[model samples]
Target chain A: DAGVTQSPTHLIKTRGQHVTLRCSPISGHKSVSWYQQVLGQGPQFIFQYYEKEERGRGNFPDRFSARQFPNYSSELNVNALLLGDSALYLCASSLAGGRRNEQFFGPGTRLTVL
Target chain B: GESVGLHLPTLSVQEGDNSIINCAYSNSASDYFIWYKQESGKGPQFIIDIRSNMDKRQGQRVTVLLNKTVKHLSLQIAATQPGDSAVYFCAETWSNDYKLSFGAGTTVTVRA
Candidate 1:
């Protein structure tokens, strides 16, 4: 079966613009999480959704938000993007929420903010 | 304000040799620890994981050792290959929490 999949592999936006990245979880998976990976750094958690409910959030600003659909797909939105927002946005999926569940990640969408 | 961190920023290992990467976490409440490998322009791939109840776990050619006393974690790659050249990260999390606190990552370069 295919792993997690993301759309718009690459995106370019201005400092004040908004961008949305999409992710489709693996079949049978019910949890999805978003992470932002800066160059030369490990991924930082942004948001996690399980069963279409917000389960957790990271230290990111209010400009970042995410929502999951009934099909286990998720969308990450960033508003009023800043140059610091330029990074790879990764989406991970697991069988369910909580511990002991292995998460599979997507290729990620590269967001470049100017 | 605890976080996971790596001992080294980079490592160079010769082919066929074993490689060891180390990480330290400050959160004693963290019960689940995971290792991930990430290549350029790609997302991280789960390598292995261990719970606080266990000290060691092994996968195909990879071993993860956790020492809760010192809050240290290590990943050992047997017979390192060129394909293993990438950045490795250690993440810590609680059993009930959904966020994964990740380390800075160690870059592994397999020499020819």
Candidate 2:
């Protein structure tokens, strides 16, 4: 079924630079979410979009944002990246009808901000 | 400021032994809870989930127990194998919405 796929399996950026990571959800999924996992910590929610509308957001700074395309794919953008921003950016997708449903995750993009 | 958290940072068990991983969540409004397994360089994969209405749910070789009284959650792995070694996390969702909060995660290592 192709599952979930993420782009730029790895990325290296300098501090203060902007970065964009992409994700393609599995077929028949309507909900997309973004999460950040710092080293030795669990993933923290960033944003969730359903039906192309923002459904939820975490406590991340305004510099972090995301949008889901009409096709259900999503992109996560970070502006003025900091060293702390160097973490795994994960994308998950699921059916939106069943109470948010069970999210299937992609391998994620390892972002390293130098 | 209350969030999902784990009791142990790491757990090591011999193969074929049963293992239990525990978590605590603060939000009483949390109606749905899930357990996810993550491997090195990969994202979290849903293992099993249980709702507040139920105290326990069982899947393949795993079981999830939820204790609303203590705001606690636990994942139990039966007859653990090396493949079962990974970081396990527990997450809770607010009843008013589906926003999820994950715990710090427990690393499970199965000894051969």
In terms of TM-score, which candidate is strongest?
Answer: 1
- Give each model a TM-score: 0.95, 0.95
lDDT of 2 at B80: 91
Inter-residue clash pairs, candidate 1: none
What is the C-alpha RMSD, rounded to one decimal, of candidate 1? 3.7
lDDT of 1 by residue, B1-112 (tens): 1112458899989899888899998799999999999998788999999999999999999989999999999999999999999999999998678888899999988889
Task: Please give the lDDT score at residue B57 for candidate 2.
Answer: 97
Residues A1-114, candidate 2, lDDT per residue (tens digit)? 698999999999999999999999999999998999898998888999899999888899999999999999999999999999999999999988234488999999999999
What value of lDDT does candidate 2 attain over all alpha carbons?
0.89
Per-residue lDDT value at A55 in model 2: 88
Interface RMSD, candidates in the order listed: 1.0, 1.9
Question: Residue B37 error for model 2, in Å?
Answer: 0.5
Which regions in candidate 2 have their CA more than 4 angstroms from the true location?
A97-99, B1-6
Per-candidate clashes come to 0, 0
